[model samples]
Target: MDFKVQLLQRKSKIDKVIGEVFKDKNGLQKTVIEAMEYSIKAGGKRLRPVLLLEVCNILDGDIDYAMPFALAMEMIHTYSLIHDDLPAMDNDDYRRGKLTNHKVYGEGIAILAGDGLLNLAFETMLDSINNDPKLCNRGIKAMQIISKASGINGMIGGQVVDLEWEGKKIDIETLDFIHKHKTSALIEASINAGAILGGAEENQYLELQNYGRCIGLAFQIVDDILDEIGDEEKLGKKVGSDKSNEKSTYPSLYGIEKSKEIVSGLIENSLKSLEIFKEKAEFLRSLAKYLEVRDH
Candidate 1:
């Protein structure tokens, strides 16, 4: 199958799983459910979950067992986005071509919605584990990987650095720290979690970690590039917010051409790390290439 078709197939599966969440919810707490549903259902690439599943597939892992983890990872990702777009953060009004959570649901509800999603993500994972005692060890390990990635040592820590350095003359080291923690951490966790669930060897796990890191950094670099020059319509969000907010980005520090070069290098490194998987990694190779040229 073509790469796009394969990607859409995985995305469709994920969407179906996510769509079933809170569907029958009602009563006084329904508003918060609506707020949570609104953000998660808003369309985007679903890259994190897709990565988890694809890695599981490559390692011949049980997709049924992995499904809950995929959903949980996406929930965590969506919650982060909801919080990231708050008035105190980036203060954005649009995401995935729709009104942001805070814009329609109000900030207080939006915050609760984000928190709700975060808690529910762990709930989903734990539910899956409790229902299948056989999967306890691997499931727990996968959950730990995701938890640390989104915790203070990972995404939140990176966010703090990014927020603190806004408009400051930051050096390359600081910029690298922000990118590695804020963006690359979760991406790495997704791949690593999948590898663990799939029973990968130590070497395979390490190589996939390298691949994840390269592509994760490249993903953010492309994001920075698009924010500078991409079409708002295609991106489904306002462009140039990074500039207005004075966020330190790859393009801001290295210039567009240089940033493109850096992305190319990262993509190359990612591909090289996948060489051991050979034909099995075709989808991931194509994904890395797509990241280099995508507008959104």
Candidate 2:
């Protein structure tokens, strides 16, 4: 199958699993649950989880066995977006072309909804262990990678730096740190987790880690470009707010043309890192190109 077809099929499968997980279960915490459902189910590419599953599938790993972890990755990504859109953060009112969770459910419930998703992400990771006892060790390793990525040293650390440096003319090192932590950390984790769950050997796993790092950085740089020149309708979220928030972006640090150069270079490096995979990594190579050029 072509990469696009395979990508579309995998995305649909991830969406189905996510939908099932958030479906009504007769729980009493209806408000938060609704908020969770709204945020996670909001239409988008569902990129992170698909990336996880793709790495697994490319390694000849069972997609079904990797499904739970893939779903957990998406849940965590959604939770991060929900929190990032809060008034205290980016303060966006819309996401994926719909009202943000806080906008519809109030700030309090939105906060809880993010918290719920984050916590439930861990539970879901554990569920993969229960699904197959032999996978228990891999699940634990995946969880640790994900936890570190989402924690103070990774995403949160980047976020803190972002907050502190907002409106300031930051140096290149600071800017790189912010991007690597804020965006790239979770992306890298998704790739690593897939490798682990897919039973990758040490060298393949290390190569994927390098591949993830390059793409993660490239992905955020594209996001920076999108914020500058992307169509609002296509982007499914407001743009120009990066400037409004006084945030430093790739385009801000380096002009738009230079930012594009940087992205192209990173994608090149990413593809090079995967050369060891030879023909087995074509999907990943194509995906990196897609991320570099993606509008959203």
> Which residue runs does candidate 2 get wrong by more than 4 Å?
none
Q: Which candidate achieves the best TM-score against the true structure? A: 1
Summarize candidate 2's per-residue lDDT along 1-296 as a digit string, tens digits: 88779779878887888888867857688878888999998987877898898888778887787888888888888888898889998788988899999999999999999999999998887877887887788888888998999999999899889878878888899999999999999899999999988899999999899999999999999999999899998998778878877778889888999999989998998998899888988889989998987877
Q: For residues 1-296, could you state the per-residue lDDT of candidate 1 as single tens digits?
A: 88889889989999999999878776889999999999999997999999999899899998888889989888988999999999998788888889999999999999999999999999999998898899799899999999999999999999899878877878889999999998888888999999988888999999999999999999999999999999999988889988987777889889999999999999999999999999998998999899889888
Quote the positional error of residue 254 for candidate 2 in Å: 1.3
Please report the TM-score between candidate 2 and the true structure. Answer: 0.96
- The runs of at least 3 residues in candidate 1 whose Cα sits more than 4 Å from the true structure, single-residue gaps closed, are none
Candidate 2 weakest ten by summed lDDT: 22-31
